[model samples]
Target: MLLVDHVTKIFDPGSISEKVALKNVDLFLNEGDFVTVIGGNGAGKSSLLNAIAGKFFINDGRILIDDIEITNMPEFKRAQWIGRVFQDPMMGTAGNMTIEENLSIAIRRGKNRTLNWGINRNEKSVFEKHLSELELGLEERMKTKVGLLSGGQRQALTLLMATIKKPRLLLLDEHTAALDPSTGKKVMEVTKKLIADGGLTVLMVTHNMKDALEFGNRTIMMQEGAIIADIPLEEKKTMKIENLIQLFEKKSHTPFANDRMLLN
Candidate 1:
């Protein structure tokens, strides 16, 4: 469903501080594939997602979603086919908008704005059903402003918003990183449910090795802006954190050194 071909992203091209965030990186995801990305600092995990989302145009290469070229498409235009949730819970939703209001915006993403601004009964019913599946009692508080929600609640809601329309590709950038362990786990559960229900194609970058291995059918390790390891489902099933670290050292010729990733 997604193809990233020989993509390279270089920041500050001719300057002394020039950094290549992506180095001819190539990746492909089949429809319904859920791939988890892992890497240390400067490994280009988030950079890959940003490139795909067109936060900035890449210096080289092509990106396609379900056969349509989107390499040079503007971010707003790409939103029609891509849905993303950021690391920061506060980044995804409007704080002042009520729960239903925020959902209404998400529901209308990439669509033409209509003259009628009211949420119809059918739309409200759909929102209630989806919120109820989160099991957070958000269905009962649809009138509450999103700003009043706790971090976990907001993140869960963000997850729902991102998937409400089932975009062609879903980009989850360390989505559960900011929540408490217990809350993060809950959000992950919701994430898994949403992905499974939609049969969505997903690329999730995460620092936690355990989550990376446990959650996805495939796990990829990146270093210095290149993908060093891509473990398929069968191989990933037998892999553990230690095995991943060993593989990283083997391929990158450097010890796994991200403390945040390790300690998590």
Candidate 2:
């Protein structure tokens, strides 16, 4: 359902500080495929997500979603087929808006807006149903402002909002990185439930190796802007974190150096 062909992205080209964020990277995802991404700092993990999301135009190559080329499409235009949750909990929703109001916006994404009545009983019921699945009692607080919720609560809500309409692809850019470990685990559970329920195609970038291995059908390791390893489902199922670390060291010709990833 997604194809990234020979993609390359370079920042500050022709300057002394030139850096390559993506190095002719190519990736493909079948429908309902969930892939987790792991890499050290500046490994192009987030850059890959950004390129796919059209945060900036790539220097070269093509990106397609559901077989339609979106290489040059603007970010807002690509929203029709993509849903993304950012690293920051505050990035995805309107803090001042009520929970139901935020959900109303999410449901209307990529659709023409009207000045009709804000949210009907049916819509509220739908919101309640979805929020109830989070098991966070948010269904009873639909009228409460999002800003008043806890970080984990808000991130869970963001996950729901991102998948409420089941876009063709979901990009999770280290969505749980900012939460406490316990809350992060809770959000990850919500994320898994949502993806499974929707049969969603997902690309999740995470620093936690165990989470990377445990959550997705496939796990990919990146280094210096290139994909060094792509472990498929069967292989991933039998592999331990220590095995993954060994593989990384083998492929990258360097010790696994990211202390944050290692500690996680």
Candidate 3:
């Protein structure tokens, strides 16, 4: 469902501060494939996703989603096929809007909007039903303003909003990094449930090694803007943490330096 070929991005080209964020990067994902990405700092993990999402134009190569070439497409035009969650919990939703109002916006993503009767009863019921599945009791507070919500609550809503329409590809950009362990785990559970229920394709970038191995069907480790290792489901099922650490060291020729990834 997704294909990236020899994609390259260089920042400040020809300058003393030039940085090659992505170098001949290539990756492919089949329909319903859930892949977790892991790497040390400066590994270009997020850059890969940004390139696919067309946040900025790449220097070379092509990107295709569901067989359509979108390498040159702008970010806004790609919104219908991609759902992205940033590291910041506050980035996804309108804080000042009520929970129901926020969901109404999400439901209408990529569709024309009008000021017709705001949030009908049927829509409210559907949103309530979906929120109840998170098991967070958000159903009781649909009328409450999102700004008044806790970080986890707002994040849960963000996840729901991102996937309400079953986006062709979902991007999770270290979304749980800002939350406490318990809350992060809850959000992950919601994420897994939602994806499984809809059979959505997902590419999630995470610095946490344990979460990276535990959640996705496949895992890809990158370093210096290149994919050093890509492990499939059968191999991943029996893969050990120690082995993974050693693999990264061998491939990158340097010890992993991310404490949150190594210690967690």
Q: Which of candidates 1 and 3 reaches a greater TM-score?
A: 1
In order, candidate lDDTs are: 0.94, 0.93, 0.91
Clashes of 3: 0
Cα RMSDs, all models: 0.9, 0.9, 1.1
User: Which predicted model would earn the best lDDT?
Assistant: 1
TM-scores for all predictions: 0.98, 0.98, 0.97
Error of 3 at 190 (Å): 0.7
C-alpha positional error of residue 218 in candidate 3 after TM-score superposition, expressed in Å: 0.5
**TM accuracy, model 3:** 0.97
Candidate 1 weakest ten by summed lDDT: 255-264
**How far off is residue 18 in model 1, in Å?**
0.5
Tens digits of per-residue lDDT, candidate 1, 1-264, equal 899999999999999999999999999999989999999988999999999999999999999998999998999999999999999999899999999999999999977768567999999999999999999999999999999999999999999999999999999999999999999999999999999999999999999999998997999999999999999999889988898889989999997777978445
Between prediction 2 and prediction 3, the one with superior lDDT is 2
lDDT of each residue in 1-264, candidate 3, tens digit only: 999999999999999999999999889999999999999888899999999888999998999998999999999999999998988999999999999999999999987776564788899899999999989999999989999998888898999999999999999999989998999999999999999998999999998788888888999998889999999989888888887898889988997666757546
lDDT of 2 by residue, 204-229 (tens): 99999999889889999999999999
Segments of candidate 2 deviating more than 4 angstroms:
none
